[model samples]
Target chain A: MPDPTSSPTLTVDSAAPNPAPNPAPNEASNETLGRFNFLAVIGRIILAFFQQVGRLSMFTASAVSHCVRPPFFPRQLLGQMVEIGYYSLPVVGLTTIFSGMVLALQSYTGFARFSAEGAVATVVVISITRELGPVLAGLMVAGRVGAAMAAEVGTMRVTEQIDALTTLSTNPMKYLVVPRLVAACLMLPCLVLVGDVIGVYGGYLIGVNKLDFNAASYIQNTWDYLETLDVVSGLVKAAVFGFLIALMGCYMGYNSRGGAQGVGVSVRNAVVSASILILISNYMITELFFAQ
Target chain B: MSASPPKIALSGVKKRFGRKVVLDGIDLEVAPRESVVIIGGSGTGKSVTLKCVLGLLKPDAGSIKVDGEEVVGLGDRARERINTKFGMLFQSAALFDSLTVWENVAFGLIQGHKMARRKAREKAIEKLAQVGLGADVADLSPSELSGGMQKRVGLARAIADDPEIIFFDEPTTGLDPIMADVINDLIVKCVKEVGATALSITHDIASARKIGDRIAMLYHGKLIWVGPAATVLDSGNPYVDQFVHGRADGPIQMELRG
Candidate 1:
């Protein structure tokens, strides 16, 4: 009865305390008797889901608002760009290059059965740009950068460094959350662009050298078949995925509790949520751009 | 400051987390340029009382005033305006790890007051020196420093911009006796030098006696005893007596199976 693709936010922490916090929630587990009401459980789950969405919405709104506000830290923003975008290039490159090569081989074999080998270039170009490029790059960055943001900010939260930031007259949301969100949103599209090219080149390599196709012919077919909307749609997906990744990372990190264990959980949840949101949004954006 | 209004005042301040009532009804005051310390066991709401004043956590009931102005439930901009006059040394020093030592010290000045970086850096170094740290430690990360050195840096940051009010949350918690004494002396020196009103919360009686003009004892969400720091050892209350002496078998019982 539950659709996994419909939920972008993690519901693990959805049962937030209504007022302050009840540290003794474990007491419920002690009641082994007649406390298991199926309807109550369903209602609780539904309410928790709504609460999580509401919290995520509020957190995102504030982070976006802070992005446009003055007193922005140019140094922090630049540092995050280098961390999220520049440092991520090598990994993205490798992934896309391999993916393109695999696509060329797979499409060649499939199209060869029908004597449509010329269609290999078109299939590789469209698939890489419209789906694989942004999705794979987004997933990789989410694992690398999302987990890092969660661990770093979560540690700060537990250690009271965030509280210290407030006392020092700096807004932690502006300083900590805004820069990462802005950098990811700006950087993921660039990474996806690079990925699309490399993936197509990978396909080209297989088609030309390994599959006995003329290099010039392969390049022409690929260039002619690739449309602007295919690439733009993926780039657009990259931006949305980037924002979702950063938002989940920041939201989880800011709310992390306990200590090291809590931080570890936050990091895991951040990556999972970011990755799922990327897949789901990738589908939605594709529909928006290509659906008849 | 003119004996008309206390520098900081709390009347019937209360806070509760779930069923756990942390601060039932705290009523205390610190006069102009005075050092007042609250002593209590762990989880006795000493930090909560200080947090209420700092506007970190809002009390469920009653009023908190700084310089005769009510601050409870104030908006962010207004609260930040009042907080501009205050500095705090957290229990863990809580220095920014991303920054070098001097940058951490100058953070409030550069970010909050919008001071020029060069000027703020100069002032940071100066404050560090006043805390007995040499200029060589300026570029080193805070993680490179020992606990005592970190506490020193925390104190330096607290007094960096010459704030009007300072709060020390367990300033001497993790330090050796000599280092704790060193910090206490620095705190006294800084308070006198800046002419700032000081409010501190600590279980360390030595820290309390050394830095406090007056001391209050909080027990189970209420301040049961309040008096001059000189008479803390002989406060005539069993709870204060138990806490001050670190007696295990007194009115303050440890929550453990015997």
Candidate 2:
């Protein structure tokens, strides 16, 4: 008799034939089924995309709702502002200056052929203020800040720190996401403004030093052609891009599952999605402001 | 006046993650100032049940009452108000690494209660002392502390508000045997000192016997046995006996999946 404490053993039927006789036929059938389900696969992908968008919309709405409520964490907000805005200055400035310099040089090469070298300064300032400054700064901040937020918040989610906050009578959205959202919204514009100045200075450097244009003329050309609307539109784009970057990072991180691999995936998704949204929204905003 | 109801009561609690049922028909009660421990093997819905009580995860169907008030579908503000009465010690300590020890301990006090930082820090330091931590450790980041110290700091944080109810999730997990016992002792001491109702979930039989007044054994998402801590070893149920004695050969079989 089997020991009463031991788990019962399963008895196999030795006389039964093996069930793998038609493996080749099974493989053919599976291949045929997979080929027939191509549309079903695409349909599933579309459904998943819409589901993700719906979830993100709800998350954004909830975060925005929490923003106007009381129990505001001023300290946390200031900390995020300093992180998302102040610490990001060096990289944003560097990217915009280099971009402006490259644009001025390229414009000079193209415009010199048309006997319009004077337009090089105009092109640099317009591109920098209305397009390059905000776009480049937004992308740089997304890569720097978005990935970090995703990784940090994703780690917190996996480790149960987010749930800990909830049990402590703290709303994770208000305590975590709102401060980040607010800071990113307020700070990205400032970064873009600073970046615009540096970018114009970079173009001025290239125009005067490399292209043999008079320094005063280059400055005057930039100032004459640069419209208030150009800079304002760029700043507005910066704010929107800021919201997208933070929202994507927070959303991806907040929902991260599994473990370190999950956090890694979230970071990648946050950076990629934020960059794409920044580019797409940049075009939309540019169309809104400058389209005839 | 109606006699004071249980601090926490759950009836017919059920939860599932996709196709896998983590909890099924869980029923439990902890009276005022009483300590109840749910002992279960790994993956037995211990944490899920605790989370349902904390409103971190909603049950698919159930009635969860706190102070005889139905809390199952309460609004966010109402849930937050109810949560003010709770303190939890996570299995891994889960201290916010961004904050210092005192700041971590005083987080709920400052952020939740809106207590002044100075006063909250004082309270945090006092609670830390109760958990046998020194003032010097207060300024250090949570990453700076050892696992045992982190658990102690976590305990200190849990009792910082002197909450009416405290939940300890796998209180002795990831510690050496001696350190585990030390934490178990501190848990008993702290729960008594604060006069708080305690609901702890752990697979550590020693911890259950030491810290729990009443012990409930959970198996396959249900309570298989519940008895006074002193009588747990003699529960007479094969599942409970298998768990309490830590036996490999028994009715309880490990579900090993690829």
Candidate 3:
């Protein structure tokens, strides 16, 4: 007799084949169907990606055109500048200072192995002005301001306030998106500039107090090594990152559907996409400035 | 008496999203100074009709003429010019939360017409009084008001610019019975006061009777019956009779999924 363990398996096999009603003939067809489905899913994903990219480019073009057009709202623009730039100072300041101190410490530790600890000041200034200052500030604002913009605009979309604006003969694009875009693009560079100063100061404090360096020479090294090109490239990157962050935030919020859950999705998407765009664009900008 | 062109008209209008059709060949007209209310259940395209006429939506196929001028695909500046003659009250009141009550009311005036702030404020306060709201509430945010009060403020805003046409979207949707009647009265008073041609969409029979001069019943994306509001209860049409009575067993079957 067949082994007892094999009995259940034998019975299941018999039952499965009978229920399928000619499974042998359909197996190849089923495999083909599954392969077709897999290909279809991938095709749909690629199409959706390109569709989103196209829509985003169109939105950016319209927003830029509106910025240059007439009928601007000065009060709205001013209020946004205060909110985006001035109110973000404390958080941005804290981030850059801590980053500067840590960079100084780590660079000194690494260079001391080669008896090159004197290079700490140059490293700190260069890193802060070229990369750390703008990147850190952008990531922080993406978390703070980008999420807030998404939530606010998403709520307006769901509640029909944006439609109400249209009914009132006001263009929502001109009134809402234009002001935020202009404000973010203009104000982020200024924030990065301030952050650069605060960051270098933090590095200086650490060099004098913790590392037993001469304050005068530390200052001299920082000022002497700093180049105008480094600062200008970073500021330009900050402006581009600002535009990307605001555009992504506004785009997500403007297209959000449903209710509270929709608003939540928009907020999460705004932060995640803004952060990713900031990092990706950071590389491209650095490559542009540094590549031979 | 001569036959004048309708202030608003829709002929063979159709709109669909993907495979689902929301409006299929809708034809309607609202004469100048007339209040026409369309009644239908959820997803029956009542709001879509109003939006089409307002140029907030573009129908897939049809003609929407306001005063003999086709508005189906007008440019932005032309649309804005046409929209100056229109005002709308949303289902949710939809006041701007960022602004105070007076600012919300004066928004169309200040932003659209470029009115002076002082003059707009005075006009907003005056409109507020017309809707039974006091000047004390003008500085408060929209969140602080009761639903009824917010509705009143919305009405004040809609008429503040003296628009020639007004659209009310579910004017009495989320209110107590007494407050609903009060809003009805205010709508009648406001429409008469502003002398605006009105178009509204709602499912409340009582509201339809009170605010609508002519009642049209929309079913499956088509207006099945249009008649005087006073005769709505006895229209004798199966769909109209079934809907006005709110009966479950009727020719218009509710799509229930098990």
Best by lDDT: 2
Compose the digit string of candidate 1's lDDT tens values, residues B1-258.
Answer: 245679999999999999889999999988999899999988889999988998889999999999999999997678778888898999999999999999999999998899999999999999999999999999999999999999999999999989999999999998999999999999999999989999999999999999999999998899999999999999889989989999898988775532
Instruction: State which docking tier applies to candidate 2.
Output: medium
- Candidate 3, residue A104: the lDDT equals 86
Model 1 C-alpha lDDT per residue in residues A122-154, reported as the tens digit of each score: 999999999999999999999999999999999
Model 1 chain A scores worst on lDDT over the 10 consecutive residues at A11-20
What is the DockQ score of candidate 2, to 2 decimals? 0.80
For TM-score, the strongest prediction is: 2
* TM-score order of candidates, top first: 2, 3, 1
lDDT for model 1: 0.91
Output candidate 2 Cα RMSD.
5.0
Per-residue alpha-carbon lDDT of candidate 3 for residues A1-292, written as tens digits (9 for 90 to 100): 8899899999899888774787776787888889798999999999999999999999999889989887788888998899899999998899999998998889999999999988999999999989999999999988888998899999999998998888898888889889999999999999999999999999988999999999999999998988999899889989988898888889999988999999999999999999999999999999999999
* DockQ of every predicted complex: 0.68, 0.80, 0.64
Q: Is candidate 2 or candidate 3 better by lDDT?
A: 2
Q: What is the lDDT of residue A284 in candidate 1?
A: 87
CAPRI grade of model 1: medium
